[model samples]
Target: MVKKNDQLIVTIEDIGANGEGIGKYQGYTLFIKNTAVGDKVLVKVMKAGKSYGYARLMEIIEPSAFRVSPICPIAGKCGGCQIMHLDYEKQLEYKEDKVRNCLTKIGGFDKITMEPIVGMDYPYYYRNKSQFPVGKNKEGKVVIGFYASRTHSIIDTDHCYIGADVNIKIIKFMRSFTEKYNIEPYDEVKHTGLLRHILTRMGYKTGEVMVCLVINGKDIPHKNKLVEGLRKIPGMKSICLNINTSNTNVILGEKVIKVWGETYIEDYIGKVKYRISPLSFFQVNPIQTEKLYNLALEYADLQGDEVVWDLYCGIGTISLFLAEKAKKVYGVEIIPQAIEDAKVNARINGIDNAEFYVGAAEEILPKKHKEENISADVIVVDPPRKGCDQKLLDTIISIAPKKVVYVSCDPATLARDLKYLHEGGYELKKVRPVDQFGHSVHVETVVLMCASSEAGKC
Candidate 1:
């Protein structure tokens, strides 16, 4: 019988959704992290359950052909990126399999077409945003870095390879400024101190940067010195302060005060200008986002004179993109701030066709469709990680748009929602996975579906 502390040899047969390697040991399933598929490893059972167990990879007897050396030394320790050890090509393949497996097993789809995953030419340093937690380590020294895997404990680091190179300089400057000025790092336990996190956003196209310091209070001592140091770095457009006095895990507060520079930074995504504030919900990867949105646009197949509805539209990013092709586009979002931003974005871009509405997609879209007697030729939904609400799916089915474009962040939830839509007489047409979060287990997918009556497949 398998017991804790038992050392066993296992051949990893598959990779789990969380990027852990799945292998069997004497009829017991073991999940060992940091091990790739087709890898033979010696594992020590950490927790042995009846049918499944967790293990620690003690030794890799044979590495998988797709295994590659990890670029980040602290990749395993940091919760940021998993599967960095896997080759980039293989990572794309694994993501494709992940989507397929979810659709087939969870959605109960018999046959579906999955296009090749859209990957970055240079996957590293693609993230436009980085949020490093600031806290004191065991030695009582202020440190700033990402939290360890599944823990709030901060790991001291000088740089994050996946983030913008400028983040390293920003973090270093903040650490030095805090040390020199004797600024206190926020203690999550006691809920004291000043600095909590350093949030930085870089514009890939415009080369503009926004640095916002999340603090326990409104003011920081020696603020001028901090701003002066940060301004030394090129492309420093905005330096703001966010006040968060709560004891919660939420990073940003409701109050945002400009400390030094402009209130917002500008970025362009394919001729579409976006004015991003500190709390705007913009895509972290602008390069991959363009590709993803382009694919979504293609799936939408808008040919002017079509009325398109973009649900869960954050800041009207996708809605604006669709507005250029469709005669009229209506965007619905739950957050009032995001809706305001969407309206501002539409106005700035001179897109009179797109209209912004503030409400839940399920409630607003259904109600609007019923009251206005509106018909959406194409409906594009980019829901959050929880996927679309069931009522939203019901509404979409009831509307019976000619085309449905679903942009999903979580494959499992996407599959579940897709199953509901499929059962509602919608047939899955095409799906293309986009590697927006490179080196991480998370993948973004764009799926195209149409009603069976429209496709003549029913």
Candidate 2:
């Protein structure tokens, strides 16, 4: 019987959904982290379950062909990037397979066509946004880095390989500034201290950067000194302070005060300009985002005279993209700030045919469809990781749009939502997985579905 602390050799047969390597020994399933498929490893079982167990990889006896030395020394310790041990090419393949498996196993559809995963040429250092948690390590010193795995403990990294180059400099500057000013890092357990997190946002194309500091209090002592230090860096657009006094896992607070520069920074994605604020849901990878949006536009197949609806529209990024080709586009988001940004973004791009609304997409769509008899030729949905609510899926079916373009971040939820849509009369067509987050387990996918009839009817 497999017991805790048992050291045994195991051969990794496959990669699990969470990027952990799965192996079996004497019919006991073991999940080992920092491992790769086709590798044989000596693992020490950490915990034993009834049918499965978790392990810590002690040594890789035989490395997989896809295995490559990770770029970051603490890559395995940090939760930011998974599958970093796997080669980039194999990573792409794994992501594609993940999407395919989700659709097949969850959606229960195997006849769908899958396009080659759109990957980044230069995958590393592509992240435009980064949020570094500030906490004290075991030595009781101020540490700034990502949370280690499932724990809130800091890994104390000087640099993150996947984050923007400017992030390292910003973190270093903050570390110095905090230490000099005698600012204490927040202790979640005791619910004491001030500085909690350091968030950095960069505009890849425009070369703009925004640094926002999260604090337990409303103000920071020696704020001017910190602002002046941050302004020394070129392209620093905005510096803001977000106050989160609550003792919770949430990073940002309800109140945000600008310390220096503008409250928001500007960035362009394929001719469409967007003003990204601290809370805006902008895509982290701009280069890959353009490709992902372009692929979505392609799948949308706008013919210059279509009425488009973009649900869960974040600052009208996709709505504006589709507006140029469609006759008119209507965008709906639950967040008022996002809706306001959407309207401003539309005006910035000189797009007059796009309209914005603030309400729950599921509720608003059904209400609009009933009261105004609204109809759409193409409906584009980019819901949260939880995917579309069942009511939203039912609403989409009832509205009966000619085409549905789904932009999904989570494959399992995407497949489930696709299943609901497919059962509602839309035929599953083409699926393209875009690697927006390289070196990470996350994969963004765009799917195209068309109604069986020209005038969609349930």
Candidate 3:
């Protein structure tokens, strides 16, 4: 029987949702971290259960053929890139299987048409945005990096292979600047200190950068010097401060004070210009995002005569793209600020047919459909990881749009909601998984579903 601290050898058979290796020991499943599929490794049981247990990899007896030496030195220690050790091609295959498995097993789809996954040409340095937690190590020295796996403990690192190259310089500067100014790193346990995190956003195409310092207090000690130093960095267009005096794990606060330069940075996703602020919910991967949106646009199959509904549209990123081909587009988001940005994005792009609304998609959409009698020919939903609410799903069924394009980050939730819609007279069509966050277990999938009654018309 498996018990805590029991040493055993197991051959990894599969990868879990969080990139953990799943292997069986005498019919009992064990989940081991920092291990990959096709790997034979010695593991120590951490927490043993009846059917399954958690284990820690002690030694890799035989490395998998799909396993590769991670480019980042601290990739294993840092939780930012979970599957960096896996081959890129294998990673894509895993993601594709992940989506397919969810649809077949969870969504209960018998035979669903699936398209090949969209992957980045060059996967490294694709992240345009990075959030580095500022904390002190056990040795009492300041460290800036990501947290360890499932823990708040920060893993010190000088660079990340998946993030922008400028992030290295930013980290170096912050390390020295904090040391020189004696800036205290926030200790979440004690809830003290000034600097909590360093947030950065880079426009891959525009060459514009925005740096926002997340502080535990209202202001910084040496504000002018900090701004001067950060401004010296190339492509530095915006410098801002986010104040979160509360004792919480949340990174950014509601209040944002621009210290210098522009309030927001400009970026392009397939010719659609967007103004990104410190708090905006923009996709971190720009290159893959353009491809993802293009796939969504194709799935939407707009013909310039259909009125489209874009639910949970952040900064009108997808809405504007659809607006270019649709007769009119209505975007709904819970964040008022994102709605405002969406309106601004539409105006800047000279897209007059798109309209923005602020409120929960579930509530606002049902209300608009009932009260305003706003009907859509095609409905595009890019909901959060939780997927669309039941109320909104019912509304979509009642309205019976000709097509429903779902963009999801979580396959499980996507399958759950797709099942609900599939039962609601929507026929599942093409489904494509997009590798938005390479080296991570997370994947973005775009699915197209047409109303069963209107399938012939669509």
Candidate 4:
């Protein structure tokens, strides 16, 4: 029970995952949002408990030297960007520290030295994709913005600090769209509306963009109008409509129909151009994606005529990339649509050395291991947030490749898989943290694994 008279001056000891100030009040830990480390501030207790207290910053008596003015005015209030207040370099440092801490503190595994965090060369224009939630403000005007942190409330941001120039233009363009079409905002309580989300992804190299509009119900009365209207917008490579009727918070919902333009997007990655369908998963930031894949290939240490197994290969991106470098690449995925897209992507790209299968990694990999007369020289696994299942990990251990390049989006899960792999005889060579998605807590990392106990680890 915090009172009016309670005042405390404390230093922010660390930064939390969602980019908050981590410290202690008395013997309990406290997490203060929108705060930086090395900042000495007086906080007013908002809610108090025996273990910890929630407090608001009364005054920053001593501010950190590293603290800088946040670029986005709605940064603290909006839940979009987290590290805008901290300098770009310092943000990378914080990410590195966070990864390392997750490895040691959470996973209880060590020995692999994490390389310096790779930051986006262009921070502000790095985000190729951004989703804006649509809502109606108190005045009943259409409010388009992101969800406030940890709440159902909305934060209407006129300007997103990290989005590309084209993205911002698209958002502004969409405002006219919502206004002209009279598209109703989705009401969470009543669960009725027309528009749900605006998803946009831009290609850095090709200058092409794929815009997807997620709607509420099946009866898209004016979808054709929307397609025709949005088609007039400049720089839009393709536009799609994905109808999501489920009462869930999952983004992209159920991809119902592909209206106007093409059902997919065409973008160039390195020398290859990929056909990205709405359901297909691709990295949001295109420029940083190039760097990330290049770094992963470098870490994989691929040799000519080597067979590489790409597990959880969405749309066979890694397989296509590694095709020319390796003798053959076998990509495995669970999503049938994605696998079909992958095969088509490979065929269109003239990548014959890559073959894709439609099944889960934990299901398909072991059968292939038994039937195939050959083992892989290199194995690359990029799983979703849940990480590798124990069965898949066992398969990986059994068919231990000469080198393993595991790409992870979740550090905690990555650390868990790493601990399992480390126990199974693979040695952690290095971890390279790539900031493909900046301003968010999510970190994309590439960990190289080498056989430590001789050539028989397989």
Number of backbone-clashing residue pairs for each candidate, in the order shown: 0, 0, 0, 0
Task: State the lDDT of candidate 2 residue by residue for 127-223, as single tens digits.
Answer: 9999999988788788999998898989887798888999888999998988788899999999999999999999999999999999999899997
C-alpha TM-scores of all predictions: 0.98, 0.98, 0.98, 0.93
- Give the C-alpha miss distance for residue 356 in model 1, angstroms: 0.4
RMSD of 3: 1.1
Which regions of candidate 2 fall more than 4 Å away from where they truly are?
Answer: 454-458
What is the alpha-carbon lDDT for the whole of candidate 4? 0.79
lDDT of 4 by residue, 1-458 (tens): 34544777878888888888876756556767777888888887776677776777778888887788887778777777776777777788888887898889766766657788888877776776778888899999888788887876878765776776676667777777788778888887788897888887776777777788888877555667667766766667788778887787876775646667677767777877888877778777877777788887898766778989899999887788888789889999888888998989898898888889988776677788788765778889999999988888888888877888998998989998888888898888788899976767778898888877643342
- Model 1: weakest 10-residue lDDT segment is 449-458
lDDT of 2 at 421: 90
Distance from true position, residue 189, model 4, in Å? 1.4
lDDT of 1 by residue, 20-123 (tens): 99999878999999999899999999999889999999999999998999999999889999889999998998999999999999999889889999998898
Better of 1 and 4 by TM-score: 1
Q: What is the lDDT of residue 347 in candidate 2?
A: 88
Off by over 4 Å in 4: 1-5, 219-228, 455-458
lDDT of each: 0.92, 0.92, 0.92, 0.79
Candidate 3 residue-wise lDDT, 1-458, digit = tens? 89999999999999998899999999999998888899999999999888999999999999999999998888887888899999999999999999999999999998989999998899999999999999999899999999987899999887888999999888898899999999999999999999999999999999999899999988888878888888888999999899999989899999999899987999999989999999999999999999999999998888789989999898999999888899989999988999999999998999999999998777777788789888889999999899988988998898889999999999999999999999999999899999999999999999999999877766
- What's the TM for model 3? 0.98
